[model samples]
Structures are given as structure tokens and as C-alpha cells.
Target: MKISNRSTSTGRRRTSAAVALGAVLALTATACGDDGSGGGEGAEGSGKGKIVFWDNNGGVRTDIWKEIIADFEKANPDIDVQYVGIASTEYQSKVDTAIQGGGLPDVGGVGAAMLAGFAAQNALEPLDGRLAKSSLNGKLNKDMIESLKAAGGGDDKLYSIPTSANNGVLYYRTDLFKKAGLAEPTTWENFYKAAEKLTDKSKNAFGYTIRGGAGSIAQALDAMYGQSGITSFWDSSGEKTTVNDPKNVAALEKYAGLYKKVTPAADLNNDFTKMVAQWDSGTIGMLNHNLGSYQDHVKALGVDKFRGVPQPTGPGGRRVQVSNPVDGLGLFKSSKNKEAAWKFIEFALSHEVNSRFNESAGQVPANLEAAKDPWIEKAEPTKLAARALSDGSTSIVQLPYYLPDWNTISKADNEPNFQKVLLGKLSAKDFLDKMAEQLNEAQKEWKQQNG
Candidate 1:
């Protein structure tokens, strides 16, 4: 929670990866078959009963989840489904509170970013055995399956079922670009120049908007690495991060400096929604989001006005960006009805249901059959992205999704410091240094515990 343009491209895998996501879809939804208050004794509970399914991205993805719940309940009248929607920004904290105090959902979205953290706490049920017994055994994407395993600490044990790969997309105003005499924003140099030239503060027009508040770290890191062309998350020795390298700091400084200079002052507190709203309501030159926001933009500004493209290439004319996070469904260890929970997951992953969900979100589908839907070909951004990545001219920088602390460090610990850098209260170097320190320590601790 994530595009609408119409075009065709043959490489949907690259496009799916490219046009897939904006926010990492690590939703902490729950689907319990018994009374949620029943608590911790559900390790071997039955599978059919009352289910409380919670969604972290309430306003953004509420409709699709609700539709899915309705379909699931309709198909299995014996199972009762409860729906709860929470804001995306507050989801992580809510999950943390639940993890510590009590109450956890039985089944829901357990994506790559949160897999490590949740698995380390023993909150998720191992799904390898369940998959082996289900009709979905050979119908899933192997790469997505591997990504989940990598996030769960490079093990053979599977904790979550693969959903879809979520990637960052660059949405721009085609009309504005034509008027400004600017080229399509496919390269970093073009991005900077267009940001400067298209901006006219007197008219309240801007080149771009920034996600400075909640969920800011991922976007910033993508920008830093995408521009600096630093492809490794860690150094050559694997003991430290290359996040604080001179090239990266320079990249971040330039990207963040657009906060008020070319972007709006409201950006200081703007999340994805607000930033997208600004882009839609006003004359925005470009916006960095995913397929999740595509429908909104289309309704607000019309499909002809804007175009969704893959993230811009670095200075060296090579496409470089952070890899997309894969999202999925997981069964919680606290569920009283494991069998019932697995049923719901299987129902949702059925070809039609999964395809509808991704089509609505403007993302790539994880189900092999769903991915083959005709809707994917008509998706402009997804197709364009496929062409960008599948053409052998791209280099994706893989973020450390395997680390248990990856989500916490990227969101809670570093988001505030990242904002400080935008406000001129901290240097880009200091922010990166702090993030590097956290990542290095997390890797070290993981090695000590795992080894």
C-alpha cells in the first residue's frame, strides 16, 4: 500500500518486482479460530471457528482485505471472520504491544520484513509441513519462497507463505514534464535537474514530495543507495555497512536537501498518504510511490495526466535500487485453530482471490496462476518496470531482510534520526553512521545466537 497507466511489456517478473510496492506489506493481521482471549494454549488447536483478522494498513488496503474476508466467509460458512483495521503507521507498535502483553492473531499477512523479528520471538508457526499437505504445494513462486526463507535467517524451515514482491515506483506528471521541456525521469541526473526546474514556490508547484515522517527510512535508504550506486548492504569483509560511505552521504544530502527547497514544508510530517495527496491535488512534478497509489492518482488526476515508471538509474547509466520486500500470509503460534487458519490462507491464495487482490493493489501476484492474469499486461508501471529490470541493465541492492532487527532499525530507531537530517538538525553522515552501527550490531548478535 501501493498505480494506473495502460501499456504492455513482456517482462512482468521485473515489472512485478519494479512496480509492486511502496510500503513494505508486513501487515500484522490475525485470524484466530477461537476466542482471542484463549491466549497461549493454541499450539495444537483445531482449525475451524471464529477468526479475528486485523489489517495494519486500514485506510489504504481496507477494502481489499474486507472483500477477501467476505469471500472467505462466504466460501466456508462454518468459519466466522472478524475484521479490524488499523493505520499502517501504528501497526508495528500495536504488534509489539500484543507480543509482549498478550493476544495474537492466528493467521494473516506475515511478510519478509517482519519474519525475522517475529520468528526470533517464536510468534509464527513453521509452515513447511502445512504447505506439504495442501493443494498449494507446487503452485507457488520458488524465488518468493526463497525470499521468505532468507528473511527467516537463511534456514530450510518456512515460517510464512509467499504473497507478492513489493517494489518502489517513481510516478511522474507527464503533462508537467512535457511543459517543463524535461526528459523522462529515468536517470538520477535528470531527477535532480527536473526537481529544481519544475519547482515554482510562488505558484505552489513542486518537483517532488518527501516521506519525512513515519516509514521514511526505507525510502531514504533506497534513494541513498539508488543514487550513490552502492550495491552492497555490507562492506567487502561483511563486518560493517557501506551505508555511511562518502558517496552515500553525498547522495542522501542531495536527496534530503529537497525537503523544503523543492518540495513542500508539509513534507516534514507527511507520510505516503499526505505526500500522495499533495501530488494529486497540486501541480507536482514527480512522486515516489508504488502501484498502491496508482488508482488514487488516476481518480484524482486521470491516467492521461501522469505516468508510473521504475525507479531512476544511478549516475553511471545503470539501473540500481533496493530490492523489493516480499509479502505473505503466516499462521501464528497462538492460534487455537491451526487447521482452520491454514484453510483461510489456502482460500485467499486461490487463483481468483489472489489475482483480484493484487490487481486492486496494482502489485504483482505471488500465485503463479494469478500472475498470468491479463490485467498485468495492461498495468503500465508494472510492464515498464519489467522492461527496465528484465533487460539485463539493472543492479538491485539487496537490503538485509534476514536480520531480526531489520524492520525495527529501519523504522523505529532510524526514522526520527532521518527526519532530523532533513531538518538540518543532523548530518547525513551521522544518520548513516547511526544506522550502520545498528545494522552491524544486529548482524553480530544474530551470528552469536544462530551459530
Candidate 2:
């Protein structure tokens, strides 16, 4: 989720390791030829041939990529997929280096956060026309596609095809809620009331855990907008943010106030992992996390003890939540095997294939048919999230992913300020205002450049 910059040496080291460790499908030059099956644009080696792919987020994702690549090759024996696994810390720099020195892979991870940089550098191949003619045209999730398009530097061209989305869930302890004679935490009012009533300082029990450390910004934004019923990230002019609106400031006031009173004191520095640990080990009332940890909670507490649900509704009974960063694949403009690369992308996103990938990744598959696989219906959070997203019960507030500096502003510039807000060292309004200034400036810069 956090793809950061790195030194040239570190990037080269990681890139070499990627090639050496997992380029199993590397094809000989004789395997390269145009077969015209993918109906793509490009030069001679454009069809049923071989293409190299770089996994932008390696380490955790390498094994799954290997499986996907193998399956893709089995389906299309003529198309060979060479997998390069680059750790996330070095991914961006490695790609940048490739762009400068002339070695961009045929395809690679173009996740929403990194899409802007790739598009900005003109490194991505536009896939709008190609996709419309392919089998995947109408089968992909519309929202996920829009998120990718917005991230593609505002050019309205499809550069990356989304594979899956991670949605946030409000996890509540059913056992604790039942014992306390409280209703399900379906609304913000009920959530706060339960949090206050469930705390027992003498016994080391608490109602909630706050992620005041790394990756705090996304959760906070969801809470603010979900409570305020704000659906749009931008205002009417489309050149500014609605994050620091007065209504959101009021919402943040109440959300941040729960830090010390009902949450553990250690929450002042807890990140998602630590916050989830506290929720799993303690008698906390609720946790705001994505589906990635559902298995952990199930293992620790058993399935009957907890349940994952969409975020509680706001005053208007509307469910508005921020979209977790979506991961997608992009074809490089420099790919000599464009048609083959496109076939690999299409093959990977096919119903059964995409299901396999998202199953291992623990995410909601972007392919509509793949989303309906029996496994998603059985997974705790993924089931509810996939259903809600597909049925239109939940509305998503897309972040300004087109802003190239968004990650820096959210993680580096504001994480400390957010912790201050939780610790009472700063007011909620001031914190939101600081974020608003940075966001508005970034928006202006983006519009100027794109226009």
C-alpha cells in the first residue's frame, strides 16, 4: 500500500534478485513472434509470443504471481511470462531507472498509488480501445475501472486494468455486544455508546482501539466522511478538497475524542497490526480494518465471536466510505510483445483466473464473475464487502489518486499531526486544515499540469 522511493543501489540489488529468483518463464528469442490473437497495437513481436512482467510489490506477492504466470502460460503455451519480483520499497525507483535507461518490462504492477507516476512519465500503454474489443470489456467492475482511470493522470485513458479492491470493514465483537445488552454497531451513535459502556479500566478491557501510528490517514478519512455523509472528495469547482469541511471537522472532533477515554493508552502509537492485535487479544468493542486480517481474527477469536460488516451509516442513514487503494496491471509502451502482453493481462483477469489471484491475495476480485466464486461468499469480510460493493448498497468516495504527491502528503506530512490530534496536542480543525492546504495546492498543481 505504501510504495516509497529508494536509492539506486538498493533498487538495482532488488531488481537483480528478482530476475535471479523468479524469472522461471524467461523465453528464448525464438519464442517471440506476432500471432495477432490479442488484437493489440504495436510492432512485429506483438502476438502469441513471450513477454516479461515486473511485480511492483514483490516479497509478499511473488508466490501468487508465479502461480498466475504458470496458469497463464498453460492456457496459452505460445505466450511465455517472465516474472520479476521487485520489493515495494524499491519498485518505484527500479521502474524509474528502467524508464530512463530503456528496459521497461512488457507489463508490471500499476497499482492506483503508483499509476500517476507511470502515466506522468508516459510509460504506460493506453488500453481503452483494446479493452473495449476484448472479452473483459463488460465483465470488469465499473467502479474499480473508474478509480484506475482517475489515477491515470486525468487523460481519461485506461492504462491499467484493476484486478481487485480492498474494502474497509467495521469489526464488532458480537459476544461482547450481546453481553453488554447493546445493539449491533450499525450507526455512529450506537458505536460511541457501546464503546463507552463496554470499557472496564480495572480489568484491562476497552471498547475500541485507534490506529494513531502509520497508515492512520485512510481510516481517519473514512470515519470523517462516513459520519458526515460526504460522498465527493472534491467540491463543486473540482479544484479543492472537501476533507476539511466544517462538517468533517465536527465529525473528527467526536471520533478523535475516543482516543484516551475508551481506547488503550498504547493506541497513541499503534498502527494497524498493533491495533488489530489489541482488538483480537482484548475485549475491545470494534475495529476499523480491511479484510486482510479477517482470518487472523477468526483464528484468535473463532468465527462465532466476531462478525465483519460495512461501516456504520451516517445521520442520513447513508454508507459512505473511502476506497482502499486498488491494484492493477499495466502494459508498458516499450513492450515489443504488446499483443501477447495484452493476452496475459486478459487471461489473468478471466473469471476463474482472477478468482485464484484474489483468493491468495485476500482481496475483492475486480472481475464480476470472479467475485461470485463460492470462496468469496464464505470469507468473512470479503463476502460482505464484495456483495455490498456489487449490490450498490455502499457508496465509495474515491481519493485524489491522480495527485502524484498524495502518498507523501498523507503519510509523511500528516501522520505526526494526526497523532497529535489524538493526543490532544492539536485541535481537529487545525489538523484537517493543514491537510486541506496541502491537498488543495496539490489539486491546483495537478489541474495545471493535466490541462
Candidate 3:
């Protein structure tokens, strides 16, 4: 369920490597078409007559995507569907190379985090008009559709169609909460109290598991917004970063202080996988992760032992949580077989097919009807997420998705600085200041280049 491009634990090891890759990507930006035009010379019009589709997460969703492709081909006997599954870790790099080298796929999976970058390069074919004429226009989730539009630079144009959405949830042990005479962690006040009460250093038990390694920034940002009540990653005008705002700094300090006392020392180096494994096998009280890890928790601890709930609300009695990175499919402008490729996308997003895919992936489907499947109805996490979204008290803190350098800043550059905050080597203010400095520079540069 993890999109390799968004999650750090997927194999992004060194910051130096990421910096090097960022440099290469920056240099190749012009190669991806800077004038909002289609791709390279030969990239125009998919003349091959074959639909070359790329599945972002090769091994994880290869079989399911292949099955969907098979169904699409069965429905259209004349169109040859070429399926190429690439691991999440390698997908972005490959796509960047293709955009520069003139071998882009006709259609491929694109996550919210990567949408702006691709759109900035003009590699994506705008889908708003196409979707309006398609059957999926009104059947898709409105929030996700809006989220995708925002991710594509807040334009009316749609660069991608949402396939599914993920959200942050706190999974807690029912038995442990009962034993401690504690209620569910619904508010930050109660959540922190529960963590403190559940931790027993002598017993090698902690309250929470911290993901200080790869992909830690997003979790930290969620905690900050949850406590600080901030609604957006950037301030009004989208030019200034509010990461180092006083309230955010206070919220971040409180979140990071839970490290040694409530979280284990080993958590300092733990990625999402390691953190989840520790929480599942050990005596942790609360684990914060996205819905993608729900199946893993169910497998490790029976469904009866634990429960997943939306993020705890802030002091204002409002739930301020950042939306987990939404994944979707984007059409390549260079493809000659655009119409045929659109047909396959339409087929894959049909209610039944979307239901089958989301069911296997254990995520909330983007198709409104597909979300009503029996599997989602029976899943507690999905039910809670649905309620949270519909309750009218939750606010999503949308990040600055329009910035092409967003992925680099949030993933690679911000991680080590966050780790410093956890290790107490850097203050929360300093961390946020550094992050804000980088983001502001990136934002300014993006405007100069893009506008």
C-alpha cells in the first residue's frame, strides 16, 4: 500500500543520494517540457497503437493491476494492453528518465506528492474534460477530486484521476486501555495522558512508536497540526511557510518530547516497517500510521485485540489531520494512443473493478459506489475514516502540493532535521526554521520558473 515515492522506508537511504538525484531531476526538468506543452519531439501522439501502462508499485499491486488490465483487454479486443510493473522505489526515477529520454508510458500511476512535479514538467495530459464526459465524473469522491486538483497547483485542470485515498489513524490496544482504566484516545489531552499511563520502562513497554527515520516528516506534520490547529502547510498567498510559526513550534516540541519516555530508544532509527513490527509484537499502547498498515496489524494481532480510530482532535475540539498521500493515475501527453488509454483507465475505475482493487489493497476506494462494498462496510478502519470525513468537525491540512520541489523537501531534506529534533540535537524552532527556509526558497524559485 505504500507508494515508494512518498514513503521514506521504501529504500531511500542516504540524503546525499537524494540530493544527487534531486540535482539530476532539476537538470532534466527542461527535458520534461517546461512550456506546458507535450513531451519531447517523438513524445507526441502514441503512434505505436499499443497501450503501455506502468503500475507504480510493481510487486505489491502487480497481480491486481494485471488482472484489471486483462479485464480491460477482454472488453476491448482490438487494443493491446502492455503492462509494466515497476517497484515504488524505482518508479519515480524511471519516469523521470523516461520524461527526459522520450520513452514515457501512455498511462501510469501517479501519487499526489508526484502530481505537481509531473504537471510542472507538462508530462501529464489534463483529464478534467475527459473525465467530465466519462462515467466516473460524478461517481468519484469529491474530497479526493478536490485534493487532486490542489495537488496539481490549485488549477481547474485535472492532471490525474484519483484511484484511492489514505488517512492517518491511531491504532490502540483495547485490552491495554481497559486495564489502565483509560478511554479511547480521541483528544490530544487524553492521548498524551494515555501514553504516559501506558508506558512502563521496567517492563520494556512504551506508549507510542516514533518513526524518526524515512517518512517521519509527514507523521510529525500531522502531530503538529493536530495539536496546533494549523489548517494549511503554507500561509495565505502560498508564498510563505508557516512551519516555524509559534504554535506549530510548541506543538512539535510536545510531540518530540515523547521520544525517550513514552517511545523506546530503538525507535530513533525505526522506519515504518520496523515501527509497525515493534508496535505489533511489543506492548505499545498507541501506534500512529495510515490505513495502509491496517491489514498488517490485523494479521499480527487479531482484529478483536486492537482498534483503529481517526487522529485525536486538538484543544479546539476539531480534528486537524493531514491527508495521507492520495494515489491516482495520470495520462502521458506524449502517448499516441490517448483515446485507447483513456478507455483502459475508464475500465479500471469502473465500480466493480475499483472495488476489487481497493478490497485487495485494504484502502478506501475513490469511487463513491465502490466505497460501499461489503469489505469496506465490514472494516472498522474504513468505517471510522468515513465517519471522520463526514462528521463535519475535521479539517484537512493540505500541503503545498503545487511546489515541484515538495517531495525533495518533505522527504529527504526534512527527515534528518526531524531526526535531530527527536534526538534533542536540534530544537523544534530550529528544525522548523530550517525547513521553512528551504521551503520558502523552493516556493520562490518555483514561482519564478513556473509563472
Candidate 4:
């Protein structure tokens, strides 16, 4: 998925706008209290009550959470559920208001990028101790769990468990490649040549496309960083940013080189939406996008017409995918219903619920058992993704607090400067120096406000 700098809107919070489609449970503050009846920390000492849930209204995977809510209510009749779906774009501001007034939901879903920022502000409750005793915790993907732990930082505490996610991979047109006498590229050099050969003026086609937009560049940077085999962006333990290092410079330079050939000059304006349009029009041979695009393309082009492969190797010969378990359900720090919330989490990740969700929604299942799920095995893209996750070819990076601004800087600063290098306006070394300067300044300013 693209790393967006814009705040999450309420509508984007839940990909689906559908209501619970179940009974509307009454809202009562007494429901989520920390009573002795297995209700949790900071909850009121009440025995029986309802749990209020706030979900993203228009996410691509909205129905999964809806179904989970229905199933949870059916299983636990004593617990009442009050559901409110929020749009993603307005979610952060809505949440900010709620947080300031101490009126958060009992349980809610959050984007992975914002998880750390919340934890840092003491807006999230640590789930490590509670989750450790659950039978389902061990069945989650280790890399996903590690990503969450890394995002939490300091104590390796888990603030939330991933429910679903998206990842980036190279989408190629096999038919075009065959006609052009090319194989799916395994390295950057070959990929460039393939793009040139694929680009036919008469055919109105190009080799590949990328989101030159900030979100796209950040995703590309994550992909490039992974291929460079550098694990951490900044070592909080060490207290320094390695963005100015020679290795990073080399990676940036390599990207600048490739930007000259395959990618369109209008990349600065391109985002996932525009890139996908090019792919749909058959005007681009390859593009980088998330799992949703994988499913969407397969549906549009036919299962055998397209395929997803690991991103090509960089100059350093490393492979990586920019992805993480981003969708998750978490209880608010101000929540009163601990038991109700945990019950929702458990039911959401249960074998049956997870499988049903993955089957219809076309996502890689968060539950490990869901990996072997029949829906995954039956679908071409899901099958490929399942194998990729199992083999550890994916890189799920922890987004830092200043992600919004970081995304902007990567685009507003590095992209134009790098584009200058591609257009022969500057040398790679000059581009790298300018990029490092901007990134360093961004890092410094971010620390001042968030750290």
C-alpha cells in the first residue's frame, strides 16, 4: 500500500460503508468497564455492559470486520456491540477529538503507519502480556509480529495485532514480454532494457510506471532500502539517522538511473490510481502496486494473463517487497470494555472468521492457519502471496512518527532533484547530496516535535 502523508479521513477509516447488518446494541459507558468479570485494565468495575466499536467505513476490506462483528455478537450474546464506521481521511481528526475529550471507542481499527505515533503518545494500551496468554497469538506471522513490536519500540510491546495487509511486487505482462523477446526481469539492468523494448510509439505503450507521487516514492524507497539489505531506517537505540550513508546514496542513485528510462516523466503526478489506469489500458508493461491491485488486475486481465513476482534485484543483488500487516483492531486506551474488545479481536482472528474474510476480500490472511486456507490455495495471486510470505521475501518496515512529513519530503525534495538527475540536469552525486540534506533536515525537525 502507498505510504500516505495525508491524515486518515473518517471515510477511509473503514473501506466499506455498510452498517453492521445486525442488531443495534445500546451504548452504555458501564459496558466496557474494568470490572472483575474479566473486563480489563482501566475499565470500570462493572459486570455487564456493551462495547462501542469504531471501524473504517470505506476500506477495501470493510466486510471482513462487519462479518467479524456479526459473528462475535452471535457467539457472545451477553456482550452488546455499538458499531460506528468512520471514513479514513477524517479518522485522525475524529480520533484526535475523541482522544482529547477522553471519549475513545472500546475497540477500533487503525492504519499501521499511525500505530507508533499513538503508542508514543500513550494513547494505546500494551497488549503483550494479555496477548501472550491467548492461544491464537503464536499462530500469527512472525515477520508481522516483529513489525508490530518494532513499531511499538522501547519494550517490544504489542499495541495491536494485524488483521490484514497489502504488499508491493512487480506486475508484468507475460504476453508483451514474449512478443518482445524478453524474460521477466531479475535485475535492474535487464528491467530497464525490457522497458525500452516494450515501449512502442505505435502501440502507445511504455515499459513500466511508478507513483512519482510522495506516497509512491516512499514505497519505492522502502523497496530500494530492502534491496540494499539495510534493516533499520534509524536506530532509536543508537540515536542517529543513516539516510546520508553511502549505501543509501548508492541506492538513491540507482533509482535515479532507472527513472531516466522506463518510468514516465509525469511520475511526479502519478499515484497508485494513475498507475493502475495505465496498467488497465495495456499502456504499461509493468507497475508496482499492492495486493489489492494484484486481485483487481487478475480479475480484469484473467488469472493467467498477469502474474506477481518479487521486485527485481538492485545493484547490490538483494530482493525485497514493500509490505506489512497494516489493518488491525485495537482497544482504545480510554475504553471501558476490555472483555468485549478482546472477544472481538479473538473472533476476528479465529480460523473460521479469518478464512471467510480472506476468501471474499482477496487478502493474505493474518492468521497462520489461514495461510493453508482453501480460498488462498484456490486463488492464483493469493497462492503466490502465501508462498512469498512463507519464504520471507517480504519486508514489513515500521513507519516512524514523522511518516506523513517524511513522505512529503521524499517527494517534494528528493523526487524533483532526482528527476533533475534523470533529465541530465544534475549528476547522481549531486542529487544524492541534495537528497541527504533534505532528509536530514526532515529527520531533525521530526525529532523535535515527536520525539
lDDT of each: 0.78, 0.79, 0.79, 0.61
Residue 165 error for model 2, in Å? 2.7
Tell me the tens digit of each residue's lDDT in model 3 across 1-451: 1122443322323332343344345434322212223333224433225678899878768888888888877878777777889876567768766665556778899988878767765677899999989988899998888888888854557898999988898999998999999988999998999999999999998888888886788899999989999888788988888889899999999999999989999988787778889999999999998887787788899998899999999967999998787888998876666777788788878899999888777789998999888899777888889889888989988777766667767876678778898989999999888788878876776566557
Candidate 1 lDDT over residue span 232-310, tens digit each: 8888888788889999999999999999899999988888999888899998899888767878888898889999988
Q: Could you tell me how far off, in angstroms, the CA of residue 213 lies in candidate 4 after the best superposition? A: 2.8
Q: Residue 13, candidate 1: how far off, in angstroms?
A: 39
Worst 10 residues of 4 by lDDT: 19-28
TM-scores, one per candidate: 0.91, 0.79, 0.83, 0.72
> Could you tally the backbone clashes for each prediction?
10, 1, 3, 38
Q: Is candidate 2 or candidate 4 better by TM-score?
A: 2
In angstroms, give how far residue 330 of model 1 lies from its true place.
1.1
Candidate 1 achieves a global lDDT of 0.78
Q: Which parts of model 4 are misplaced by more than 4 Å?
A: 1-57, 74-98, 101-103, 133-137, 226-240, 250-267, 315-317, 320-326, 359-363, 379-451
Which lDDT value does model 3 have at 274?
A: 81
How high is the lDDT of residue 335 in model 4?
63
Question: How many residue pairs in model 4 have overlapping backbones?
Answer: 38
Per-residue accuracy of model 2 over 1-451 as CA lDDT, tens digit each: 1134322223423443233122121111112123212222234364766688899768657888898888888888888787889975467767765655455678888888778766765667788998999999999999889989988878898899999888899999999999999999888889999899999988888888888887789999999999998899999999889999999999999999999899899998887768888899988889998876787688789999999988988867878899788889998766668788888899889999899888876688999998878888778688778777778767889888887667667766788889999988999999998888878877876777678
Off by more than 4 A, model 2: 1-63, 73-106, 201-203, 265-274, 334-341, 386-393
